[model samples]
Target: MPAQALGLPLLPPSKAKGKDFRRGVNMAITGGTAMNFSFYKSLGIENLVWNHGSLDTQIQWFKELLPSICGREQSCKGYVRKSLFMFGAYGGNDYNVQLLERGLTPEQAMNYTPKIVGAIANGVVKLIALGAVHVVVPGIFPTGCLPIFLPLFGDGDADLDDAGCLKAYNLLPPDQVPQLDAPEAGGSPPAEAPQLDEAHVRGLLRPRVPDGPGAPQVWV
Candidate 1:
């Protein structure tokens, strides 16, 4: 039987004496911590695979390349009972792009986060259906710490998304730091806080998911 570590600690085989009891696969995403890699290796796992790059790339790679490799002649050729599958990453880069550059309001961003998360969860289920006996889907990191977020919220005052880079990025506290008094920060309120335009950014961060599965089609 094939075994997958999925970036988890390797466990000893049924038989000891340092003999490998089974074939193993290690799959990890880029930006995934080293601790995950170390944990798998320490358990004496040999085969390793990784997913690194943009979300689209990672998805494509998982759906295509990883499966192809695992099912190749050398990898799983003549085994009587063969199992092939993958472990996918947690988190995505779209929210950061939307918040920092596209200038989506938090409310708009929040609305999309759940959908994106749900899609990922469904992707995991699809992987399982595709002969993936085990799949590991990690969670998204707290995004308030991206370096790009620093200048966005420079004045330490709560900022609203005017659909402008300066506004949306500035809405989030830099480094996820608690909102604290910035000694001399100053910005005039524009007579009133602008109401969030829901429809404007809804399409930006999370494009309307297709009727089924394909590249995320953008309205524009």
Candidate 2:
């Protein structure tokens, strides 16, 4: 079963929480909630790469220079080289790609999101075939509640889960940028939560990115 489907907690109490540890390294997977961190640790992870915004930025940079990066690694003659097993929740920005650039309606961006999803799936499959073991793939959190999303939609009904972020707003139509960026123009107060528009709610359900740079090309 999928991790989420199996009903796993995002984070659990660590056995090392209260104990004094003088000589051990703890690899924390930071950006993530307690869910996968504890779960993966229980499965034997001592060092974490801190998978928060820092890692996300890394992934984004790599995606932008994918060809150069893949080539450099492949051509390198390293004494201890191993197949790079890369996995991530990629292509979550399709709606933004479509809405922001293509001038697609929020509804239209919804229709166009699956294209992005497929590309990410294909990339993952190729990585697996390349002999990657112990792969961990996580999906994007709700797009609607991103600081960009909440102020724009202003949907009070919207709520953030344990991660203090909404996974729902991420799905809004491409034109939703104004909604996502609405708080920026406001005089003050970072919008903690806002009511999402019908378009915003509808847009969050689907995911897609098209050819020619897709999500990575934007804001570049």
Candidate 3:
């Protein structure tokens, strides 16, 4: 989700709708799909930081955007605080962590489900306190239907359900987990248990930055 990647096809603001928002030479045009590009044009995002990492790493990425939230004067561009925060589709990595790293059974990972939900909830609360007026938390997808889980957890055709997915692995839809806490803000889920005022650091969030500047931080 880099700025150049988004803006290039989006046609800046001027080229898309005949209204120029800034003064600059147009680089490329994406044909007559201008109307569909409206949302990206109006987003007015200055920077975008993205990477393939677990939920914890995503949180750190959010913090990296923190300084820009308040603007560092002559140093950094200013982005309003608490404007809109989008996080997650997490817990996928939780499964990966348990199966790949922890060597825990699916049931054991399921048992740890509550903590995972709690961490998400805590992250939401923390973001709100930090400066997020609106937070968007998306639910995880059904791993049972995914190709990865079918072979890893399934046992031949007997394990396949109506959709040819693994029934043994899919206890409940991944989206049905306890978290879906805040439906108001784009269906972001919450934690299972009440988290301490800490940043709800557990699972992935805990291992990376357990100590130092934001040590033992819990969001809500």
Candidate 4:
């Protein structure tokens, strides 16, 4: 399906009261990271992450709103089972913070990929504990292909790939991809989960390229 058909409209801010969530609510925040600020702080990285809407924060918000969204523990379980959860495209900004603010090279930034992916896996486990049956956890996209990265990192022909995307920046390692098939991350999500294939999800999440001359190029 198209990205627009994913679900309901933008949810009100976490502090907003009495908002409708019957359809669904978007908890995603701009500049949100998988790991919290404290995680970076422990590593002596300061003044890097500006927005504090980390994954843990958003999940906490969901826990608080659950009562209003569905009453009673039993009912909440049913509500969650029937609902679709889109976990993330996290780790993008996690790397960005290291690269842009901490002055780490892309390779150096990749050293934290395991931890970043682990954080997202932990999030999926949380949703599963909350009775989430079908959680769609999207992996990070090709950073080099991003328009923002293209201009910022591109230097010369040596840096560009055959497709003109920066070779160094498009470093989404194979192992870093979230594996829902793992037993810990809900173990293949049962038979009832939405049967979204790899190609379909990729198409939905792919950065939009311009169709024709003067056509707008939209990025996800």
Give the whole-model CA lDDT for all candidates, comma-separated.
0.37, 0.37, 0.44, 0.66
The model with the greater TM-score, 2 or 3, is 3
Name the top lDDT candidate: 4
Better of 1 and 3 by lDDT: 3
Estimate TM-scores for all models: 0.40, 0.35, 0.49, 0.72
Using alpha carbons, what is the TM-score of model 4? 0.72
Q: If candidate 2 were superposed on the true structure by all CA atoms, what would the RMSD be?
A: 16.7
Best by TM-score: 4
lDDT digits (tens) for residues 1-220 of candidate 4:
4555986366566566787886688788888998888888887767744466789888988988899889999999889878887777777888888877787878888677646655665666566677775667666777778887777777888999999888888874332333233443323322222222232222322222224553322221
User: How many Å off is the CA of 97 in candidate 4?
Assistant: 1.3
RMSDs, each prediction? 16.7, 16.7, 14.8, 10.7
Alpha carbon deviation, residue 11, candidate 2 (Å): 21
168-214 per-residue lDDT for model 1 (tens digits):
44332222212111221111112222232112112222322323453
Clashes of each: 1, 34, 16, 0
Candidate 2 global lDDT: 0.37
* Regions of model 4 farther than 4 Å from truth: 5-18, 173-220
What's the true lDDT of residue 13 in model 3?
25
